[model samples]
Target: MSEPTMDHHRWGMVLARPRGLLTAEPFWSETADGIEEGLQHTQILFFLHQVPGLQEELEVYRRWSAQGFVHGVILVNPLVNDPRPALVDQLGLASLHAGVETPAPGSASIVSDNVESTRRVLERLHALGHTRIARVSGPSHLAHTHIRNTVSRQIAQELGISVRIVAGEYSEESGRRATAELLGLPAAGRPTAIIYDNDTMALAGLATASALGMQVPDDVSLVAWDDSASCQLASPPITAIAQDVHAFGRTIAQCVRRIESGESSFEVPEPAHHWLRRASVAEVSPPR
Candidate 1:
């Protein structure tokens, strides 16, 4: 099939963070080629996520749609949840579908199952005989927190377990603060296990536990998601759920291709999380 191309005056895009540490340069160069050949000069709008004024960028995109100059907006970071509600009350759900002046049929997004993955990590904790468990979650602004929080609550209810949730912003500092908070609880209130959303937070938790003279799987067990290189290099290797990020990027690119081709939005197949068996968890011992 021939590659689809947009007319000079036809298409526009509203990109977010297309040039970040996470972005692959070659892929972006290809995307730039498509936009240049397929769009009117005024039709393309690129907004970096770290830009000072996001609202202003979105406003211009909204205006393009309002004036019927653009077909729709394509967000680069498909993982991030809707920020319109918090950013602009005028641009709520209703306005989104109608104001864009395009049918919502082809709108697509992609994200990992934060809830199910966290549940798996929690189940591993339960298997280790950990009754008291705590969670260090990433920022609440994104939809990832919503999924993780819901799944955690469900698992805890079914297993008759309790989880203490500490909010962190996916940074070492936030991780440290959360770990300190977890350690401050009374002996009886302290969790026998702690889980983090990402690998970085997990490493911080381990460091904090060591500072408090707690040994992994001896005093408390540890678990986290996204098995990064740091987890493998730790003194006692960490157990984690690993996602194929390269495959994830390719899948997202495919999804974008489908949308660009005017195809219906389709759900991407669920990516399996690989469980890395390691020495972080030990069988729970009964009270001495």
Candidate 2:
């Protein structure tokens, strides 16, 4: 097919996130909000959509490219060996990605410091004297999820502690199920503390633990990634890894600006995140 006419455009850029209740979470929503605010003063027609699936996403790119209706596409919830980046290149659409594990060969990236974040979360738990830990992680194929699991395992080995990761789909049901499974393990094998990949799951885990008659921090400690009002408003506010998500979204906007300005592919600098101590974490109690 002949090259896209490149003569007309209906939208300045687009972003498509994976379809799920997870997409309704604070992280992606806030990021979109920030990007919009960041681009507010300009006329960069930004489009954020929750397409049906991967194939639909690719089709959006193709349709938009064919119509010369989109100038670029933002890729989020990237997976290991993600194909969207390459597809964007194939369509000659400018692009930006929200991850770095598999770099977008020709796109600007706002790489979250997942490895560092994972380390900080683990180190904080370890320092509190919790030796047996478990994490309720997101889908296994997500690049960030895999990175967190791998890094957490490495840190666990270094600390000589036991760490187990359970697969979760970033939903209430998954959280409840995974938490029950972890908490049901024999006393000798159960974790003393738990980490959740998102506040939604974390909240569910907290409820599940309580439904099972376990007290947060007292019976089982909890930590959540991607802090939110729900996490903060829980019975005993859950400890969480907090980042300036609004600022993060603005940063992605900046990357979009720079990418449009013809800047070379580069990683946008992201602010560091920290573990927010709350009522949900405690040093492991002495064994009877």
lDDT of each: 0.60, 0.81
Model 1 lDDT per residue over 1-288, tens place: 563442322433344331332232223344444444433334333322233234655776566545554444444322244554333234321121111212235445443465567777778778767878888886675456767777888999888888888897556666778988888888888888877877767888889888988888687777766776678888688877776654554454455445546554545543567677678877785541
Model 2 C-alpha lDDT per residue in residues 87-163, reported as the tens digit of each score: 88898888777766545565578767889889888888888888899999998868899999999999999998889
Q: Candidate 1 clashing pairs?
A: none
Q: C-alpha displacement of 235 in model 2, angstroms?
A: 0.8
Q: How displaced is residue 6 in candidate 2, in Å?
A: 4.8
Cα RMSDs of all predictions?
Answer: 8.0, 2.8
How well does each candidate superpose onto the true structure, as a TM-score? Answer: 0.69, 0.92
Which stretch of 10 consecutive residues in model 1 shows the poorest summed lDDT?
Answer: 93-102
Question: How far is 72's C-alpha from truth in model 2 (Å)?
Answer: 0.7
Model 2: lDDT to the true structure = 0.81
The numbered model that scores best in TM-score is 2
C-alpha lDDT of residue 68 in model 2: 86
